[model samples]
Target: MADWNAGQYLKFEDERTRPSVDLLRRVPLSDPQSCADIGCGPGNSTELLVERFQNARVIGLDSSPAMLSKARERLPGLTFVEADIATWQPEERFDLIFANAVLQWVPDHPGLLARLVSFLKQGGCLAVQMPDNLDEPSHRLMEKVAHEGPWASRLTSASAAREKIGSFEDCYAWLQQAGCAIDLWQTTYVHPLEGAGAIIEWFKSTGLKPYLDLLAPEERVEYLRHYMEEIAKAYPAQADGKVLLRFPRRFFVAQRM
Candidate 1:
């Protein structure tokens, strides 16, 4: 996949950063000395960490140069590193390893969670929030549309870009075996938007990238038109003529002992 488009992702900055705010509110740490924001796209979530832990040394890590550049520009005082979550090796540990909307893109949740836990100091917390809306209409429609187009053959496995993250129960079991106390929950946010076009722009930054990457410019235009038509059918406009995009997310805070 091409480097993440930081500008595209930040279009819905407020909405995209809302979950990070909620997740950070539950991090049961009084004074974490060191912190790392994994997949800290454009520093929105990383800025939250700095504000909440003013005294801590906060660093943002991401694989995308565009994102890291934006993040660095957003907060030049803090450290930003280019690193892949799946293969990152740090020279030192941290009191908080925050992964907001990042882990889903990395495979092997059990192993990945354990590895994150390993990076924390004793009593340190590993806080994570991941979109759990694969079964939702928006995503289901992505798969549906992917298969119905001439680009279907090339995009056959695009849906697999985000592998099944497994159930929250499975996540609990994994953390338990990793010797951590866990707090986990699920939430569905009904985000109101102008129309299906707004909805398309939202996912175009994240979930829709894999499919769009495989198509020609004209083919992408056609694919998006079909997607928009399906989205209109799936998400009815509300009383004020706006559509509601239901986004489900899973959050967990695991404290290492």
Candidate 2:
């Protein structure tokens, strides 16, 4: 997969940040001494973590320097680290680890979860939220568009491969196997926004990254145009000139044993 376009993907941070915060709130972190926000794009969620745990020393980690730059700019008081979560090794255990809307992009969910669990202090909390919208129309349409359109042949390889997203049952079981007491659930948020094209704009910031990167400059426009056309038909605007986008996400909150 092509590297993420942090600038584009960061646009949806405001919309996603709330849900992520709500998920994190479920974890009973009264006063964590140390915290880490994994894949904390642009520091939006990282700032939330800082506010939630006022006394904690919070660190935000991301692979993109551009993202870290923005994060640092937004949160000068907090520290931001440029590191790939797949290989990052924390020197000491953390009282809480917050990973929101990140793990879905990593290939090995189980292994990554295991590593993050290991980084937690005994009784430390792990709160994670991932977009469970892969099977939803918004994502499915991207696959359909890429696999059947003019760019079918070249873009087929860029399509997201079918992988386990770790359902509530799977997540609970994995946490149990890792010796954690877990609380797992799912939430579908219908984010209502003005304009019929907002849905397309949302994906431009995220799901469209890899596909757009793989295409020629000219083909990119064509792909986006095609994508928008399809999205309009799939998600019709309401009478008030707004669209209701149902974004379903999954959550896993576990306390390390």
Candidate 3:
């Protein structure tokens, strides 16, 4: 797949970063000495860390060069590393590890969560937020479109690029084994946007990337046309001509004991 498009991702920056704001609020740490923003796309969430923990040593980590470039420009004074969270072996642990809207793209939730926990010092926190919207119309439509077109053969395994986040019970047990006390919850944000096109623009930077990346340019156009048609049907326009994009996200702040 192609590298992430930071420009597209930032089009809805406020809505994209709102979960990070809420996730940061639940972190119990006070005056943490260090913080790492894992999968810190364009440094939006990392900026929040800098504002809240004024004196802490903060670093943003991401695998996408486009994202890392934008993040460095967004916060030039801070350090941002290009690294894959799946196999990152930090030289030292951190007082806080903040992962916002990134883990769902990674596989092995059990191993990933445990590895993140290992990077936290005792009493440190690991705050995470992932979109739990695989069952939603937007995503279901992606799979449906992928399978129904001539490009179906090329995208047969495309949907597997994103891992389905496990249940809360599954996460609680995993974090518990990692010796962390956990605080987990789920939130569904009904984001009001202009119209069906706005919804397409939103997912184009996210959930739709995997499928679109595999298709030819004309195929991608056709696929998106079908997707937009379904989206228009799934979400009706409100009295004000806005569509509400129902996004469900799961959040957890685990403190290593």
Candidate 4:
């Protein structure tokens, strides 16, 4: 995958950061001396960590250099490291290892999460949040469009197979096996968006990026046009001409024993 565009991702910063803020609030840690923000993109969520854990030595870790660069520029006082959360290991354990809107990109939740738990010191916690909206219309439309058109082959092979995150029950068991006391829950946020194909714009920065990136310039425009036609039917406008996007996310906090 190409490096994420920090500027593009920040366009809808408020909507994207809400889940992070909500997830951070559920963390039961009162005074974590050391914290790591795994897959921390652009540090928006990391800022929340800093506010709550003022005394903690907070470090932001991300695979994208572009994202890490923005995180560093935004908070030069804080430490930010560029590394793949999947393979990257820290020399020392952390009191809190937090990941928001990130694990969905990585495969093998069972192994990956167990590795994360190992990074936490006994009594430390691993907090994570991931979008569980793959089956939602906004995402389904993308998959449907990807498999229908002439662009199907390229797009499907390039990026259409969304990461397979295990079910809620499976996740709880995964954390349980890691020897942690876990808290797991989910929430759905209905966002009212305006303008034509506002839903497409919402995904353009994240999910749509891969498909768009894989296409030719002209193909990109065509794909969006076709996608817009399909999604508009799935998300009709309200009386006020606004579209409501229902996004569901799952959150978990595991305290290592």
Candidate 5:
């Protein structure tokens, strides 16, 4: 939202990164010459790719300068590029195009997935993972708050930027159209978050970013206050004071024909 604070994002790094590890494990490849991490975001997902394909050319791409800076700092030897995934065109195609937890942010599922598939070399793999948790309470609260009161008009842009996760059936169909053998599945991870207001802090770097960014500084305070109020009611603390966040994500690995 506001230049993507990598430090804030890494606060829940372990939980956020688990999906990348899981998604990487499912990618079937013997030897990929080149790999790209779309929406790499501080290079967490790209790091996983590097580990799996030690000799491959692994490049991390992201729109956020701050995120890329942190990524470059963390992985100095790796190449990181600043580019929007929605419009970026690489000089060379990749053997494995891995986009973990990123496609949801981009629009036009049918076209975007097709374009990504095109970036793959013949027999290359396109692996993607995205949050499908919009129906969940935390995200519902985001929609509810953004649509209520004076914030609605101001939040329209942020709302539009989000809310574009097409159905899994639609994505699978698109991969089929692109001529790929696909492995698609959904995983629901109930993460145990510690400390007070952890859920609010969790989304600060993610789902809450757009809403928080659109609001004025003062408005953001009131906006997040209201959001936290709703989150607290929805996600009550356990006896040890940890909150369980049910994060559901969908994954697909398509091997191009």
Candidate 6:
């Protein structure tokens, strides 16, 4: 099982919810009878699903026990389960499956997408949002630095492990082939935060997970410091004491035939 820090995951609940809310707004949920939130970290979006589908039985499924514990503590009445999205099977399927910022981690994008869509009832909706920033400088820099740096020898063994990342067109084509009417688009969220170090902190919670796990304790700190310095140079702060961060994300809403 992939280990994760509950405290660190839950800390970004509020920050994650901002984009989640925007994605949910585009969903055409008239009255879902049953809903599932895959990769429901800390139940941030799970709580929103509850309010949106009051009569529906909502289930929040995640692989992390720590995160599931936090979810249960925050919302006792709602259901939260420890399950991997790649292998999880619903007892009776769902009317709606809401997956926000989760698909990027799965190994088989096509297979995973097919499996999730198969669980949807006829006419049921599958709404998903994933980070499309793999092509951006933020992520590319990590790859560039890792492969060329002094620590490259240590990471060489794991270098072939590919992260499942796809383009908006790639997602749209896949969903269309699966026989779902798809609505796809890209949105760049410019989140303005206070001062320089805040962007580094934000990434530490979200984007730095994989890279951090690969480094030694001391090397991890040095890597982060070096990364922050590089990022700060490009995204200098304004006179008002804030930094504007452009985070590009892709959304796909597909309804079963």
Q: How well does each candidate superpose onto the true structure, as a TM-score?
A: 0.99, 0.94, 0.99, 0.97, 0.96, 0.92
Model 5 C-alpha RMSD to native: 1.3
- Best candidate, lDDT: 3
Clashing pairs in 2: none
lDDT to native, each model: 0.94, 0.83, 0.95, 0.88, 0.88, 0.79
The C-alpha RMSD of each candidate to the native structure, in angstroms, is 0.7, 1.6, 0.6, 1.2, 1.3, 2.0
Q: Which ten residues in a row have the lowest lDDT in candidate 6?
A: 155-164
Clashes of 6: 0
Model 5: per-residue Cα lDDT over 1-257, one tens digit each: 56888899999899999999998898889789899998999988888888889989899999999989988988899999999988999989999988888888888889988999999898999998899888899989988888875789888788666646767788789999999999999999999987438888888988889888888888998888888888888988999898889999999999999
Error of 4 at 225 (Å): 0.3
Model 6 stretches astray by more than 4 angstroms: 156-164
Q: Give the Cα error of residue 87 in candidate 6, in Å.
A: 1.2
Model 1 residue runs over 4 Å out of place are none
Better of 5 and 6 by lDDT: 5
Error of 1 at 44 (Å): 0.2
Model 5 segments more than 4 A misplaced: none
- Candidate 1 residue 179 Cα shift, in angstroms, is 0.8
Please give the distance, in angstroms, between residue 116's alpha carbon in candidate 1 and its true position after superposition: 0.8
Model 4 lDDT per residue over 159-182, tens place: 533567788899999999999998
Error of 4 at 209 (Å): 1.7
- Weakest 10 consecutive residues, lDDT, candidate 4? 156-165
Question: What is candidate 2's CA lDDT for residue 250?
Answer: 87
After superposition, which runs of candidate 2 have C-alpha atoms over 4 Å from their true positions? 1-7, 161-163
Q: Estimate the lDDT of model 3.
A: 0.95
> Which ten-residue region of model 3 has the weakest summed lDDT?
157-166
Residue 148 in model 2: shift from native, Å? 1.5
